[model samples]
Target: MTTLPVRPVTDVPARPQPAAPRREHRLRSLDGLRLVAALMVAVYHYAGRGGEVARAWGTSPAEQFPTLHSYAAYGCLGVQVFFVISGFVICMSGWGRSLTSFFASRASRLLPAYWAAVVLVTAVFALPVVAYEAVSPSDALLNLTMLQMPLGVDRVLGVCWTLWAEVRFYALFALCVVLPGVNRRRVILFCAGWTLAAALTRSVHEPLLDLVLMPEYAPFFIGGVGLHLLHRDRRDGYGWGIVAVSFLIGQHYAVRDLWNAADPHAFAHRTSGGIVLVVAFAFVAVGAIALGLLNGVNWRWLTTAGALTYPFYLVHEHLGWPAIQLLHRTWGLPSYATLPLTVAAMLILARLVHGWVEKPLTPRLRGVLNKAR
Candidate 1:
């Protein structure tokens, strides 16, 4: 048997499969960041009222308050940060999931709480004590559907305008993800093209389409998506560097033209300023990802606060206004005192609502949704 001397079977150790890149789940830092953004928005609105009071009182004190006014300016930027975060987080959470499941999850998560807030706000507006003029049934229905923005109808829940924008963003993203032949590359290109077109059109003061329909804010979302893609793939460092530079440039321009402007409205003169702010926001989104801040250290308290933020955001504006009015009428608290007090009250109430209402209700609602499905 010319069987070649059977080579001693060499036992080759199977190469250990590379440990699946540690799949990170909880991102405590992002929760903390969300808390910071939410607080900024709350403080902004509170301080904004103070500015109005100062103006009405014809006192230089309001303008000189420095801290309050500074917060107000910075607070406006919070919304931009929110948009970026929304794009990044939502996309990351839902990527690769089926569109149906994604939409169902989103509907379950968002609609119950959102509808509750809307009804509560509307009911308050209907009450004799707080009675503002009732919205027409048509307007109310439109708002409920969250289609008011696309239709160019007036917003029923004033603070909810951003929610409409967010809804649209989600819808577009779902379409991109679910449609046949739509891959990550195509989605990226589509988003980039859409954003560039929107920015270019807006810069020229041409309305190619209504803000709601055209996705004028797509760039911020795309920037977020881009960051996610870059980070997930372990691409070259240049992308991160570019994102950082873009952020700094955007922030510099915002501070110089918008923050430092003697007349806040003057910054609005150069419509390009808004574009710059969007760019800056995108930068922050990428930086958060690259620095791992969003997915890094977990702070339970802040995470809890972040969980309550959406409801707080919705309720605080209306609640603060009334609380301020009550204090002004009864105690005649000075603007400085009243502003901080109103903010504190709103925060307290938000925590209560989150714990007592939203937290409890969310799970039950989700269960119902799952059963229905």
Candidate 2:
């Protein structure tokens, strides 16, 4: 949702006179892809899984949206798609930035809408508008810090779990690559080392290693970095190798998640082969974007659509469910009508959060952070 600034050229030729900086082209297509990924996740939560809505409506959503439910089940893979995009975007944006500036950029980009959503969701849960679980004040406070997962506290919004994973990726990236200064060699090594560490995670007993390595999600991010390398410089053999290996490792984890899904009822009917295929598609899609295959897609409206993606993802699950419950059950609206209405309302809410919360706060937060620095 927060597209990092275009990256600086890493392969500029030497000249006696100082050369002007040439920023990489902004991949607006990636922004459009982000919105698609967000929508996929949203659809998955609302229609794919029958559990949450089934409890509220006394009927299965799968049965309600018979045609859409099967396809929607695979929408959960949108997270992996996001990670791949993140790897490419983060690496691109972080290339020429300072560590302090990087932190400031990330904090500014993430926190405002996140803080607003935490409070909004907390307030929603506190009210009797829906039968959803209420988040306590303490949990709300911890969530504001965005460190609730490691703090052993519950998330204010269940979707914030991905934020934690992203945070870990940022920390690891900053420490290993950004802090040391981003370059072709260091980035390649970072991806390579990360791939190896993730591969070995299943054989290791160290909790911290597994936690930091995030073996299940590592390949997507690693593959993303590899993709960025290709984007930055097309003749990167090591980058291609990294992408290939990461996809292989990432596919294994994706299939594993399908089989060992926490909510077996939601994914029980899904096949490992389907999961593998979907994950492979995500990688391929991202790879195509990185290689500039979609350069011709410069639809200006996608910029606005992309801007709403982050907040859309944040509020869609916890908040949308209640809206669905209220509309379908309380107002006697049918699933056909309720699903689209809820999604539209959530998108509008996301736009509001983006405009009122994120746009206004990001600059101020960045200024404050920069001043502190």
Find the candidate with the highest TM-score and give its number.
2
TM-score of each: 0.74, 0.92
Pull out the clashing pairs in model 1: none
Clashing pairs in 2: none
lDDT of 1 by residue, 253-357 (tens): 445544444566431222346546545654665456545656646657767777777777777776565676667545777777876787778777767767777
The C-alpha stretches of model 1 lying farther than 4 A from their native spots are 1-24, 49-67, 131-138, 152-154, 181-187, 199-216, 234-282, 293-296, 364-373
Where is the poorest 10-residue window by lDDT in model 2? 259-268
Question: Candidate 1: minimum summed lDDT over ten consecutive residues — where?
Answer: 266-275
